[model samples]
Target: MKINNLKNLFKNNFVKNIFFVSSGTAIAQIIGTITYPIITRYYTPDEFGVFVTYSSIIAILSIISSLKYEFAIPIAESEEKAVNIVFLCVGILIIYSSIIFLALLLYSNEIFSLLGNEHLNQYWYLIPIGVSFIGIYSLFMYWSFRKKEYLAISKTTISQSFFGNISKIGFGFLNMGAFGLIFGDILGKSAGITVLSKSFINNKCFSKANLSEIIEQSKRYIKFPIYSAPSKLLNTLGVQLPVIFITLLYGSSVAGFFGLSHTIVSIPMSLIGTSVGNVFYGEAASIGRKNPKKIKELSNNLLKKLIAIGIIPLITLILFGPILFKFVFGSNWYQAGIYAQIIAFLVFFRFMFTPITNIFSVFERQKEELYLDSFRLVLVLIAFGISKYVNLDSFWAIGLYSLAMCIVYFVTYIYAQKILNDEIKKI
Candidate 1:
């Protein structure tokens, strides 16, 4: 009877969406995991450093690509209004992509030089293209979530992962270097866009959203652009700081190891946490507005789920990360395994915190999120600063960085709980 009840609970729409999203993510990640051995064998760590550098640059810039107006799509009160928000986000993204292109044209060389990867200059032109694809995908994804089109989203995720990893391996064998990785990323996104466009972009929805509607919707969610966007940007920089600083301080080889470790850890996050978060965001927003008490209960349930699911994998990584990395990615990547061990705890915190972080949006606490992100940014910078000033080795420096971030993530979880409890009291 208990098992049946649990199975029934998992059949709820929120859980169903999570299941579909995770299933697709699992397939995608499996493909990536299988291909990684071949891809890593074909490409050197130094080359991966260049790829990571290029990716980090775009990752930071892409946060502001739509000024974050895309975040409002699912939260909008009505489908028509949400449709307008999508168009509004797309318009802003176009402008942002153009601005990035011009800036890159003017300073791509200097920027790559500063990041300690001048070799990335040849691929700089791809940044705008990559940004546009990612930005548009984010916007479209929110709209899909609003419509509860989980199957479509799942299909696109699988398509992207399948095509993207395959291309990277193919290009690697061809000796295309970092461009292979970059091109593969771009191609994967293209596949996603093509799938989503066919799935959701129709004349009826597009026609309902006009210039005036777009402008009005943008104003309605202006807080997203003003506060949420910068917070998101800072959060992204914090996440990518190791990639940037490792490259600058310890050189690209160390950065490569760190980047690969991060990529491996992020697979779980992308597959499970991100999928659940998207579904949770949609459901939480709706429930929080009607019966606010349900929000608290739902959050608690999710917290339990995240922690319960994450604990074992995290422990396994901390214990045998080096052995696993060597066995899977060859002896050359053993350093990546070590890096993974140091950061494994932090990844656990991240896995739990990321999905629930959307609770900030549910409670209209974007400002608090901004403050937390700012503090996180300071902590990351201090970690790098202390390492540089004290002449610490790469391993110790990374340890310090991971420790600080783990502390920050714990505080975030506490803060989120408090926010949820307080909101429950008010209701």
Candidate 2:
């Protein structure tokens, strides 16, 4: 009887949807984990650092690649309207990519010098290409969510993982260096987007989409381009700041160590939190539209589950982070394990908050989210600035940075909860 009841609970559409996405995420993460040890062995820390540095740049700029209009797709009132939004976003993305391409051509050398890495200059041209793929994939992903095509979304993730790793590992064997990792990332994104976009692309549904329709959709969702775009840019910079600062202040080696540590520790968040966030965004938007009173209950349940799921892994990392890193990734990554230990608390809260954080979007609270994200950016910058001026050791600097982020995440969570509570009560 108990087993039957549990099965029935899992049958709930929201729960089942989460399972579909998370199951694919789990498989993808597992594949990455299995292949990572080998990839690490083949690629040096400096090479990984170079790749990540470029990735950080792409991440910062990619925020506006689509003007973040992709975010509005899920909540748009109708599929036809959502299709127009996608076209508008893609139009912006093309113009954005062309602008970036020209900028890189003009200032690539100066930017490379500012980053304190000459090796990255060679990878400059790939930035626009990679960001284009990322932007397009994001559009397809949000469209998939809007349509509730969870299964297709899940399969694409797994396929992306499989194909991307194949290329990375294969290139490593060919001794391609950082180029291997960079291209792997791009190819993976291409594969995923191609899979998600087949139906929409084939039907040419947007061929009849007129400039006026695109303009109307753009204006209707202007909040995303204005508020959400800058907010997202700041948020990306905050997350990638550690990489940028570490590379500038210390060197690529330390940056690489930090990157590896962050990547490993974030597996659970990527695998579980991302899946939950996507599903939550869709379900919450639906609830907000039809039944506002249940928002608090949904938020509370999600919070409890996130906390429970995260506690054990975080505790284990705090206790045995270094040993785990050494055992899993090799002794060279021992320092990354230490870094992971310092950041575990922050990751726990971030993991718990990220999925539910979209509630701000569901409620059209982009202004509030923008404020919170800006505050986080300021705090992170201050943290790194103090460490730089004080000439602290890299370890202590990361500790300080980690501490700052943890506090910010906690505050953000509380703010979100209060806002959600107030909104629910009003409804």
lDDT of 1 by residue, 34-64 (tens): 9888889988899899888888888999989
Note the clash tally of each candidate. 0, 0
Candidate 2 Cα misplacement greater than 4 A, ranges: 202-204
Local distance difference test values of all predictions, in order: 0.85, 0.86
Q: Give the C-alpha miss distance for residue 106 in model 1, angstroms.
A: 1.5
Q: Write the per-residue lDDT of candidate 2 for residues 1-427, one digit (tens) a residue.
A: 9999989989889889988998998898988889888888878889889888888888898877998899998898887788889899899999999999999899999989988888888888899998998899889999888878888889988988888878889999999999998998788867778778877877686675778888998989888878899998988888888898999999999988888888888887656888898899988877764455676677678889989999998999999999998998888888889999987877887888888788778877889889988998998999899999999988999988888888877887788788777765665
Clashing pairs in 1: none
Q: How does candidate 1 score on lDDT? A: 0.85
